[model samples]
Target: MQLSRFTDYTLRVLFYVAMNNDRLSTLNEIADFYGISVEHLRKVVHALAKSGYLKTFRGKHGGIRLNRTPEDINVGAVVLQAEGAEPLIDCSGLDCTLSGVCNLQRALADAQRAFMQELNRHSLADMLDNTAMKQRLIGKAV
Candidate 1:
Protein backbone atom coordinates (compact mmCIF):
# COMPACT_ATOMS: atom_id res chain seq x y z
CA MET A 1 0.00 0.00 0.00
CA GLN A 2 1.25 3.44 -0.93
CA LEU A 3 0.77 6.63 1.03
CA SER A 4 0.16 10.06 -0.49
CA ARG A 5 2.86 12.68 -1.02
CA PHE A 6 1.13 14.92 1.48
CA THR A 7 1.52 12.30 4.19
CA ASP A 8 5.11 11.67 3.16
CA TYR A 9 6.11 15.31 3.36
CA THR A 10 4.23 15.83 6.60
CA LEU A 11 6.25 13.09 8.25
CA ARG A 12 9.47 14.60 6.93
CA VAL A 13 8.55 17.99 8.33
CA LEU A 14 7.77 16.47 11.73
CA PHE A 15 11.09 14.69 11.78
CA TYR A 16 13.04 17.87 11.07
CA VAL A 17 11.13 19.77 13.73
CA ALA A 18 11.65 17.03 16.29
CA MET A 19 15.38 17.09 15.61
CA ASN A 20 15.64 20.83 16.14
CA ASN A 21 14.29 20.60 19.68
CA ASP A 22 14.37 24.08 21.24
CA ARG A 23 14.50 25.96 17.96
CA LEU A 24 11.39 27.29 16.27
CA SER A 25 11.84 26.09 12.73
CA THR A 26 10.67 28.24 9.85
CA LEU A 27 8.82 26.97 6.82
CA ASN A 28 11.56 28.18 4.52
CA GLU A 29 14.23 26.58 6.69
CA ILE A 30 12.61 23.18 6.48
CA ALA A 31 11.81 23.56 2.78
CA ASP A 32 15.37 24.58 2.04
CA PHE A 33 16.85 21.90 4.24
CA TYR A 34 14.80 19.20 2.57
CA GLY A 35 14.98 20.83 -0.89
CA ILE A 36 11.20 20.75 -1.13
CA SER A 37 8.89 23.38 -2.56
CA VAL A 38 8.15 26.10 -0.03
CA GLU A 39 4.66 26.59 -1.41
CA HIS A 40 3.77 22.94 -0.92
CA LEU A 41 5.30 22.85 2.55
CA ARG A 42 3.37 25.96 3.54
CA LYS A 43 0.12 24.11 2.99
CA VAL A 44 1.37 21.08 4.91
CA VAL A 45 2.63 23.27 7.75
CA HIS A 46 -0.68 25.07 8.02
CA ALA A 47 -2.57 21.79 8.12
CA LEU A 48 -0.24 20.41 10.80
CA ALA A 49 -0.61 23.59 12.84
CA LYS A 50 -4.37 23.46 12.59
CA SER A 51 -4.37 19.83 13.69
CA GLY A 52 -2.41 20.74 16.86
CA TYR A 53 0.84 19.05 15.94
CA LEU A 54 2.66 22.32 15.48
CA LYS A 55 2.12 25.89 16.58
CA THR A 56 2.87 28.88 14.37
CA PHE A 57 3.81 32.44 15.22
CA ARG A 58 3.76 35.60 13.13
CA GLY A 59 6.54 38.20 13.32
CA LYS A 60 10.12 38.88 12.30
CA HIS A 61 11.33 36.20 14.68
CA GLY A 62 8.30 33.99 14.34
CA GLY A 63 8.34 30.37 13.29
CA ILE A 64 6.81 27.01 14.15
CA ARG A 65 7.33 24.39 16.86
CA LEU A 66 5.68 21.22 18.02
CA ASN A 67 2.70 21.76 20.32
CA ARG A 68 3.48 18.58 22.21
CA THR A 69 6.61 16.60 22.93
CA PRO A 70 7.87 14.35 20.17
CA GLU A 71 7.32 11.32 22.39
CA ASP A 72 3.69 12.34 22.75
CA ILE A 73 3.10 12.66 18.98
CA ASN A 74 1.97 9.16 18.11
CA VAL A 75 2.87 8.22 14.55
CA GLY A 76 -0.41 6.37 14.04
CA ALA A 77 -2.48 9.33 15.17
CA VAL A 78 -0.50 11.65 12.94
CA VAL A 79 -0.90 9.33 9.96
CA LEU A 80 -4.67 9.18 10.49
CA GLN A 81 -4.84 12.99 10.72
CA ALA A 82 -2.61 13.45 7.67
CA GLU A 83 -4.41 10.81 5.64
CA GLY A 84 -7.70 12.40 6.75
CA ALA A 85 -9.23 8.93 7.12
CA GLU A 86 -8.37 5.29 7.56
CA PRO A 87 -6.85 3.71 4.49
CA LEU A 88 -9.38 0.95 4.15
CA ILE A 89 -11.13 -0.41 1.05
CA ASP A 90 -14.74 -0.43 2.12
CA CYS A 91 -16.93 -2.35 -0.32
CA SER A 92 -20.23 -1.41 1.25
CA GLY A 93 -22.56 -2.13 4.14
CA LEU A 94 -24.99 -3.70 1.69
CA ASP A 95 -24.94 -7.34 0.78
CA CYS A 96 -22.62 -8.16 -2.10
CA THR A 97 -24.07 -8.96 -5.50
CA LEU A 98 -21.55 -11.82 -5.69
CA SER A 99 -22.90 -15.18 -4.58
CA GLY A 100 -19.86 -15.87 -2.40
CA VAL A 101 -19.17 -13.40 0.42
CA CYS A 102 -15.74 -11.92 -0.23
CA ASN A 103 -13.65 -11.20 2.83
CA LEU A 104 -11.53 -8.59 0.98
CA GLN A 105 -12.80 -5.66 2.98
CA ARG A 106 -12.31 -7.42 6.28
CA ALA A 107 -8.84 -8.52 5.32
CA LEU A 108 -7.83 -5.04 4.19
CA ALA A 109 -9.17 -3.54 7.43
CA ASP A 110 -7.12 -6.01 9.51
CA ALA A 111 -3.94 -5.26 7.56
CA GLN A 112 -4.45 -1.52 7.81
CA ARG A 113 -5.11 -1.81 11.54
CA ALA A 114 -1.95 -3.81 12.04
CA PHE A 115 0.03 -1.19 10.14
CA MET A 116 -1.42 1.54 12.33
CA GLN A 117 -0.92 -0.47 15.48
CA GLU A 118 2.80 -0.68 14.71
CA LEU A 119 2.87 3.05 14.18
CA ASN A 120 0.95 3.58 17.43
CA ARG A 121 3.70 1.76 19.26
CA HIS A 122 6.13 4.53 18.40
CA SER A 123 6.27 8.33 18.28
CA LEU A 124 7.95 11.10 16.29
CA ALA A 125 10.72 10.98 18.87
CA ASP A 126 11.45 7.39 17.97
CA MET A 127 11.76 8.19 14.28
CA LEU A 128 14.03 11.20 14.76
CA ASP A 129 16.89 9.01 15.87
CA ASN A 130 17.15 7.56 12.39
CA THR A 131 20.74 8.07 11.32
CA ALA A 132 20.13 7.91 7.61
CA MET A 133 17.48 10.60 7.63
CA LYS A 134 19.70 12.90 9.67
CA GLN A 135 22.74 12.27 7.51
CA ARG A 136 20.77 12.63 4.26
CA LEU A 137 19.34 15.99 5.32
CA ILE A 138 21.78 17.56 7.75
CA GLY A 139 25.16 16.09 6.85
CA LYS A 140 26.47 15.15 10.29
CA ALA A 141 24.73 18.02 12.09
CA VAL A 142 27.52 20.44 13.04
Candidate 2:
Protein backbone atom coordinates (compact mmCIF):
# COMPACT_ATOMS: atom_id res chain seq x y z
CA MET A 1 0.00 0.00 0.00
CA GLN A 2 1.23 3.42 -0.92
CA LEU A 3 1.56 6.01 1.85
CA SER A 4 -0.16 9.35 1.55
CA ARG A 5 1.79 12.56 1.09
CA PHE A 6 0.92 13.55 4.65
CA THR A 7 2.49 10.38 5.96
CA ASP A 8 5.51 10.91 3.74
CA TYR A 9 5.95 14.38 5.13
CA THR A 10 5.55 13.11 8.68
CA LEU A 11 8.33 10.58 8.15
CA ARG A 12 10.52 13.17 6.52
CA VAL A 13 10.14 15.49 9.46
CA LEU A 14 10.97 12.72 11.88
CA PHE A 15 14.01 11.62 9.90
CA TYR A 16 15.40 15.13 9.65
CA VAL A 17 14.83 15.89 13.31
CA ALA A 18 16.27 12.59 14.48
CA MET A 19 19.38 13.20 12.38
CA ASN A 20 19.86 16.62 13.90
CA ASN A 21 19.21 15.51 17.45
CA ASP A 22 22.23 17.39 18.68
CA ARG A 23 20.42 20.69 18.06
CA LEU A 24 17.01 22.09 17.31
CA SER A 25 15.79 22.19 13.69
CA THR A 26 13.62 24.96 12.32
CA LEU A 27 10.62 24.33 10.06
CA ASN A 28 12.00 26.73 7.47
CA GLU A 29 15.28 24.81 7.35
CA ILE A 30 13.53 21.49 6.93
CA ALA A 31 11.23 22.90 4.30
CA ASP A 32 14.17 24.36 2.43
CA PHE A 33 16.11 21.10 2.63
CA TYR A 34 13.22 19.01 1.33
CA GLY A 35 12.00 21.71 -1.09
CA ILE A 36 8.52 21.46 0.38
CA SER A 37 6.21 24.26 1.49
CA VAL A 38 6.90 25.65 4.94
CA GLU A 39 3.17 26.14 5.41
CA HIS A 40 2.56 22.47 4.84
CA LEU A 41 5.39 21.63 7.22
CA ARG A 42 3.84 23.84 9.85
CA LYS A 43 0.80 21.60 9.93
CA VAL A 44 2.94 18.49 9.98
CA VAL A 45 5.07 19.81 12.83
CA HIS A 46 2.05 20.84 14.84
CA ALA A 47 0.49 17.42 14.53
CA LEU A 48 3.73 15.73 15.46
CA ALA A 49 4.03 17.87 18.58
CA LYS A 50 0.42 17.21 19.53
CA SER A 51 0.99 13.50 19.11
CA GLY A 52 3.89 13.67 21.61
CA TYR A 53 6.46 12.69 19.00
CA LEU A 54 8.09 16.11 18.86
CA LYS A 55 8.65 19.07 21.12
CA THR A 56 8.47 22.60 19.78
CA PHE A 57 9.91 25.79 21.19
CA ARG A 58 8.84 29.26 20.24
CA GLY A 59 10.58 32.65 20.15
CA LYS A 60 13.61 34.18 18.49
CA HIS A 61 15.63 30.94 18.55
CA GLY A 62 12.66 28.58 18.39
CA GLY A 63 12.76 25.22 16.63
CA ILE A 64 11.78 21.56 17.04
CA ARG A 65 13.30 18.40 18.43
CA LEU A 66 12.24 14.86 19.13
CA ASN A 67 10.53 14.49 22.49
CA ARG A 68 11.60 10.89 22.64
CA THR A 69 14.81 9.18 21.68
CA PRO A 70 15.28 7.87 18.14
CA GLU A 71 15.19 4.27 19.28
CA ASP A 72 11.99 4.89 21.22
CA ILE A 73 10.24 6.07 18.07
CA ASN A 74 8.97 3.05 16.21
CA VAL A 75 8.80 3.41 12.44
CA GLY A 76 5.68 1.26 12.16
CA ALA A 77 3.91 3.15 14.94
CA VAL A 78 4.68 6.44 13.24
CA VAL A 79 3.42 5.22 9.87
CA LEU A 80 0.28 3.71 11.36
CA GLN A 81 -0.60 6.94 13.15
CA ALA A 82 0.26 9.12 10.15
CA GLU A 83 -1.59 6.88 7.69
CA GLY A 84 -4.73 6.82 9.84
CA ALA A 85 -7.40 4.14 10.07
CA GLU A 86 -8.41 4.12 6.41
CA PRO A 87 -8.27 0.81 4.65
CA LEU A 88 -5.68 0.33 1.93
CA ILE A 89 -8.27 -0.62 -0.68
CA ASP A 90 -11.74 0.88 -0.59
CA CYS A 91 -13.62 -1.79 -2.51
CA SER A 92 -16.95 -0.47 -1.19
CA GLY A 93 -16.78 2.55 -3.47
CA LEU A 94 -16.82 0.39 -6.58
CA ASP A 95 -19.74 -1.57 -8.05
CA CYS A 96 -18.20 -4.96 -8.54
CA THR A 97 -20.30 -8.11 -8.58
CA LEU A 98 -17.57 -10.23 -6.94
CA SER A 99 -17.05 -7.82 -4.09
CA GLY A 100 -18.25 -10.23 -1.41
CA VAL A 101 -16.22 -13.16 -2.69
CA CYS A 102 -13.05 -11.47 -3.86
CA ASN A 103 -9.84 -12.65 -2.25
CA LEU A 104 -7.91 -9.70 -3.62
CA GLN A 105 -8.93 -7.46 -0.76
CA ARG A 106 -7.94 -10.03 1.81
CA ALA A 107 -4.68 -10.63 0.02
CA LEU A 108 -3.97 -6.94 -0.02
CA ALA A 109 -4.82 -6.64 3.65
CA ASP A 110 -2.40 -9.45 4.47
CA ALA A 111 0.28 -7.80 2.41
CA GLN A 112 -0.23 -4.54 4.22
CA ARG A 113 0.01 -6.34 7.55
CA ALA A 114 3.29 -7.89 6.50
CA PHE A 115 4.55 -4.55 5.28
CA MET A 116 3.84 -2.97 8.66
CA GLN A 117 5.36 -5.92 10.46
CA GLU A 118 8.61 -5.38 8.59
CA LEU A 119 8.55 -1.70 9.39
CA ASN A 120 7.90 -2.56 13.04
CA ARG A 121 11.22 -4.35 13.11
CA HIS A 122 13.03 -1.08 12.71
CA SER A 123 13.13 2.26 14.50
CA LEU A 124 13.88 5.79 13.33
CA ALA A 125 17.52 5.19 14.27
CA ASP A 126 17.69 2.08 12.13
CA MET A 127 16.97 4.02 8.98
CA LEU A 128 19.69 6.54 9.80
CA ASP A 129 22.37 3.99 10.60
CA ASN A 130 23.97 4.05 7.18
CA THR A 131 26.94 6.45 7.12
CA ALA A 132 26.41 7.53 3.51
CA MET A 133 22.67 8.00 3.98
CA LYS A 134 23.22 9.97 7.17
CA GLN A 135 25.70 12.27 5.43
CA ARG A 136 23.45 12.73 2.43
CA LEU A 137 20.23 13.28 4.36
CA ILE A 138 21.75 15.62 6.93
CA GLY A 139 23.70 17.32 4.09
CA LYS A 140 26.91 17.47 6.13
CA ALA A 141 29.90 15.40 7.00
CA VAL A 142 29.30 13.13 10.01
lDDT of 2 by residue, 1-142 (tens): 4788888999999988988878889998899888899999999999999999999999998999999998999999998888875667779879999978999888888888899899999998898889987886778412
Model 2 weakest lDDT span, ten residues long: 133-142
Local distance difference test, candidate 2? 0.88
After superposition, which runs of candidate 2 have C-alpha atoms over 4 Å from their true positions? 92-95, 140-142
Give the runs in model 1 whose Cα sits over 4 Å from its true position: 93-100, 135-142
What local lDDT score does residue 100 receive in model 1, on the 0 to 100 scale?
Answer: 54
The most accurate candidate by lDDT is 2
Candidate 2: clashing pairs of residues: none
Q: Which candidate number has the best TM-score?
A: 2
For model 1, how does the per-residue alpha-carbon lDDT over 64-120 read when each residue is reduced to its tens digit?
A: 888989889999998888886654776666566952578787788889888888989
